[model samples]
Target: MASGALAKPQMRGLLAKRLRFHIVGAFIVAVGVACAYKFGVAEQRKKAYADFYRNYDSMKDFEEMRRAGIFQSTK
Candidate 1:
């Protein structure tokens, strides 16, 4: 009976707790990375919009054509 300590309930509970901690830690890291990527993409889009608006008047040759989405590449 002395060797039954290896199969005790307390030991199983401790292992389960450790596993949960590892899974939660991985989840938190993944969410952090996703948020950072979202933030960076939004900043890039804002900058592009600012540049396009600033040059709207200078690019008058294709003014109406550009507005009609003729220059957009589907690929």
Candidate 2:
């Protein structure tokens, strides 16, 4: 009935607003860190792929794998 009628008023003014600002700032920092990590990983993948394709020899790799018994054909 009047359960929340004396709930000490939902926290107003400076301290409450400061808490909100701090939370928002922390959220922004977390997002920034996540984006930085994402971009770093993407750059690493790009470099790895670039290095891989830089000297890619498809048939050479296929024959190597075949020699290693990967195909089970004994070729």
Highest lDDT scorer? 2
Q: Tell me the TM-score of each prediction against the true structure.
A: 0.46, 0.61
For candidate 2, what is the lDDT? Answer: 0.89
Task: Report the lDDT tens digits of candidate 2 across residue range 1-75.
Answer: 656655576565879888899999999999999999878898889989999999999999999999888997667
The candidate maximizing TM-score is 2
Please give the CA lDDT of all the candidate structures: 0.81, 0.89
Candidate 2 has a TM-score of 0.61
Instruction: Show how many residue pairs clash in every candidate, following the order shown.
Output: 0, 0
Q: Stretches of candidate 2 above 4 Å error?
A: 1-11, 14-16
What local lDDT score does residue 45 receive in model 2, on the 0 to 100 scale? 93
lDDT of 1 by residue, 1-75 (tens): 465545546764798899899999999999998898878897788989998888677557567677778888621
Which residue pairs does candidate 2 place in steric collision? none
lDDT of 2 at 21: 97
Residue-level lDDT for 26 in candidate 2? 100
